[model samples]
Target: MEDPRTDGAGSARREPEAAAWGERVARFVRGRVFPRESVLDGGGPEAAEALAALRAEARAEGLWALPLPAALGGGGLSFGAYAELAEAEGASDHGPAALGSAPLLDVTMLARFGRPEVREAYLKRLVAGEVRTCYAMTEPGVPGTDPFRTATRAERHPDGGWLVTGRKWFTSGAAGADLVTVMARTSGAAGDREGLSLLLVPTGSAGFRVVRELPVLGAPGQYEIALDGVRVPADHLLGEPGEALAIAGERLQLGRTLRCLRWLGQAQRAFDLMCERAATHDGSRGPLADQQLVQAHVFDALLALRTTRPLVREAVALIASGRDARTEVGLAKVAAARMLQQVADSAIQIHGAAGLGPDTPLPALFRTGRAARILDGPDELHITAVARRVLRTYGRAG
Candidate 1:
């Protein structure tokens, strides 16, 4: 097979095959697995047998971990290609989450800075779906947009380990996570970006505890974690102290790009649902599709999907091409979130009261829709970053 990483842009490559495989994977999940999404409706263990069977099948069919490094037992798709595949997976809630295929910031840390043993221990398990991990950076009372304001403290331990103490909320998937990639201040560094480090803490470790699951407006569950003297060996530290911000910033850009792709899938799904509802509903004299208001909403949803998809695709391509697209990714993140919100809202409006009820899928989609504005750093933060980049790149009359 041709190496996707080495192929030149716009050159004839194996992307078609990769996209075909992604479609197959998406179809398999949609046909066989989505019906079981009800398992995750309430706080409950996913249908273990079905889930395990799907994982095994995915692994056998070379569709396991698309985002991890290929040498580490993952599909060797590039970021651009992976973004396309991610859109398909993101169309349904269970697909991306269950596959453990979303963009993982900690994976970048482990790949770039971890020791060989650390990679073998953590990355392998994560890629194989044997464990789930969460990145804990945001504190409960602190504004998550400003990392310099974090209050979590990690003190050196006498036994060659570290003691981590803090409270974290809005942690995605932390409830069932096997480990947490925690960010804490280790030194008395003057700047927020300094004196910080990333540590790996096991879930049931000495002082690691989950306080409660937070209920999002539309999603199933998130978790609040309290680390009261959680201890881990010194080897748990990822990268050197005071390098957390740089590492996290780089990782966050990649995360935002991935999120844009996922939300594209979500927006497309909503658009499709809206169209289907419009075509079939007969509350008006004509089909909803025949109504000018309904047509206008559908047109707006299509435009949003079209506009955001290319921006996200371009951002992913730029990042994959070894360019730093912190600004572009930020702008794309904001646009994608807004577009998805608009699409979801239109879907609900087209469906009328039925959309709000449990019988239709729009309510569930609305829950996911509402979080687009906040997840992976909110719109305000990204907008600020975009402005800063704009000023630095094109300052007044320089």
Candidate 2:
């Protein structure tokens, strides 16, 4: 059979050069990077050193960040071209970070609206992986998808600074983050979207505290933060006081697209795992591959993956072309997230007890799949958004 790494809706549609670049990234991940999973996860000093060395190696091989501009220390791939490369890089959770491209969101946003001082201080460092940043938007009470419900507040100080006060949770990578882009109300009340602002709060501030780490699936990944009058310079404001929502929308569109690509890669990984199990695991009668029931699992996973792939690419392409892609992104978000969750479930079922343990990557991939549905935005939110958009089309016709 052909190598599954180069097989997909996105890969088939990609130009030869683009597809080859993506394939090279996949091969690098599968070979040089996959073996260093332990060092990446160790979260220790030694692991840090090893990961830094690995990033240097990956960069030297022209496999670094592919989505950002080349002027910003990236591979200069457009969103359309980066879609397939993202899939290859998504084969492992550490693939993007290890390759020096994980800060795409922050770097892109900084380049667009950041103050000169702020950009000088953090932008290059972020691209170089010298610092880590987290986005704090969800609070203790608001729905994660509703920016209007944010309870965080920022009060302007007399000295051209602001005192931010609020509590945020599920702030991913906050434990070690050097900075956080906090969304807080500067002029409007709760449930008002127009007054929200994004403030670049340095983690060393007196009141910017890391309350605790919130573990998902029994592992610590996200964090809770308490901003008790955290002071930030006036220039820390991103874009403008009332413009964060629009900026956030742009960032989220790109983020969701990247996630879809990553999820596709992960689903493909699970699909391969299921196929391997079916081919090798012999039961009472014969190899699982010979049994119709096992074949059903493989077929279903492939179907889900193949179907979701095109929808995701459609969304990515729309976003790439600067078109209004809310409907497409909503559809892709719900489908790709569900696809990953379902494929991971099937792969787990095929592996039985072995899939539950750490001996395989299935367990971790399953956790990511589950989170994919709820993170960024939940499936329910996207489903409603997509349905409403479709209904609007019918309304217009009628």
Candidate 3:
């Protein structure tokens, strides 16, 4: 398919295709994912089976991994085009996993930097959903904000393979992953920026072990892992030695943008729930929608959602075009996270006790909202990073 930005006419043509796909994904999420959300979120053999069934159905309907590269057995939608569908696909937390888009970051990274053998080994299986992967970067007792201080190290064995040693916590999806991409220092001291590299380790490797599950806001996915001299072949190294930071930076640019899109979807759902309750639920005073305070919640939530969407879209466009997008992504990440929390809080308030209970999805939505701020490098990090980048331009001008 032609890149829409390559020509004037292609831009108009791609819009309808993306819109149509977005609608299909949205419908699937509503019909398939929403109904099974409780089971999917519960995390067990039953949840795994339900999720696998959903994946099968998604694949049968031709809705699996639309955003992934076509060569990798996906629909091969461009990032910009996929941005249109991401919101719908991410409405429920399980949407990405069910629809086969969850491994996007790992797939792309391995494809770009993996040795021919590494790609041959895992890329196709990964795209085909035959396996699962997780990323381990943050460590327990260490501030994830400062990755340069990572204490994990990978030493070269006599055979020239790598033996990795360290611990990582909050590694999402680690419990079931077939492979894990680890960040470890190959040559630098703990505080040095250079010499860090990424290595692909099979979960079944002798020394690799999952220490424990680390629940986030009561959700079951994150894990603490220990890599005690886990060995990997020389070719499993991603990019050049000391290139981990560069590669991770590129990955995060896209990851944060995708997250912003998902947060917007969640926020929109919360807003809808808030509106529905206000309109239909009649309290002692009258319909909640008739109350002035309830109206305030609706107005504020709508304003936030509207204002944050454009920021996220701008970031998506920039990243899709392969330009530097740090400033835009940071702004969108903070805004979308805050918007989700604010909107979901209002939705829960409108639902009263029912929102906090298992009867409604408000609590789950709110939990995500609360966690969004901390995950992917908290709001303060983005706020300061964007500010620093902006101020640098002024410094250059002066």
Candidate 4:
């Protein structure tokens, strides 16, 4: 049977040419990136040189920017098709960046809300991998994941610009991003959701600074940044003033769904490694796969993977159909995050001491699995939100 994950598009849907494209992506990453991740992660000149070569290879294969719109020079794959491709691309940590598809979210957002000049300046370069960007919404004093408590402020300048002042943290990719989209309070009082606005700040601006590259759960690249009286041109404002939430909502809906797809891929990769170990490794009594205890672990891991796959697909299907999938996404987010963590634990236990070492991918996968629940809104927040949203159906006030 065709794997339902790739085939779930139904008979009426387009042929999942992605099954072939995805295989190509997987092969490229496994051959080019999977073996060189350590050098890339080391942040050395050799890593940069290797990455440039790998990216060039991806571009040569016409694999660059597969996630954006074809009109924007992307492959124009549907969310479903991209989901298949993303799963394969995600098996390696550097796959998206190496393949020139890392800017999908930023490009999509800029295309929707940027002014003509802003679009002209950054859109094409972003699709072509000439630049990179990050979104900064989390602030130090605010309640994490609660944008209503945002303290960053952007005051309009008299000469067609704005003065942005604030400190932000957990801004992913900020260390290397050329432009940063910052969510700040531009109108209304603190805690007023409607007053928030997003502004584009060039990293080289006068008062913009990257304070430090945050070491999140032993992972780098996340950063803390400060913007003190940073002046940005008026045209850089995204969407309308006092309406950042709506634009942010659109980005998050798709962003969260894509993260779920990638998480599924990472989990599947770990599961494969775990099974490979079980089948081949010698144990106290023989092959680990021959042991009943190890059999239980394999059964449980497969069960979790199969169960979460459909819930995530349901959310992806709803979002692809342009429907509000808050509940579906929330459920999938929690399930996929926990599933990855659980499966990683099982994989580690099966690998014994080898799991925690650098020789295996389990340690890295485990770290990401642990961070997943917290990064895209913590599991607690999603659980409460999903419960509240679901309870509202029976006329119950959550």
- Ordered by TM-score, highest first, the candidates read 3, 4, 2, 1
Per-residue lDDT tens digits for candidate 1, residues 242-318, read 78887787778788787788788878888988999999888738777889999999899999888888888878878
**Worst-scoring 10-residue span by lDDT in model 4:** 1-10
Per-model C-alpha lDDT, please? Answer: 0.77, 0.83, 0.90, 0.85
Candidate 4 residue pairs in backbone clash: none
Q: TM-scores across all candidates?
A: 0.92, 0.93, 0.96, 0.94
Local accuracy of candidate 2 as per-residue lDDT tens digits, 127-160: 7778899899888877887889888899999998
Error of 3 at 17 (Å): 1.0
Off by over 4 Å in 1: 1-16, 46-50, 189-192
Model 4 TM-score, 2 decimals = 0.94
| Comparing 1 and 3 on lDDT, the stronger one | 3
Pairs that collide in candidate 1 are 218-367
As for lDDT, the candidate ahead, 2 or 4, is 4
Least well predicted 10-residue stretch by lDDT in candidate 1: 1-10
Best by the lDDT measure: 3
Candidate 2, 303: how far from true, in Å?
Answer: 0.5
Runs of candidate 2 with Cα error greater than 4 angstroms are 1-16, 396-398
Per residue, candidate 4 scores C-alpha lDDT tens digits across 274-367 of 9999999989799999999999989999999999999999998887777789999999999999999989999999999999899988998888
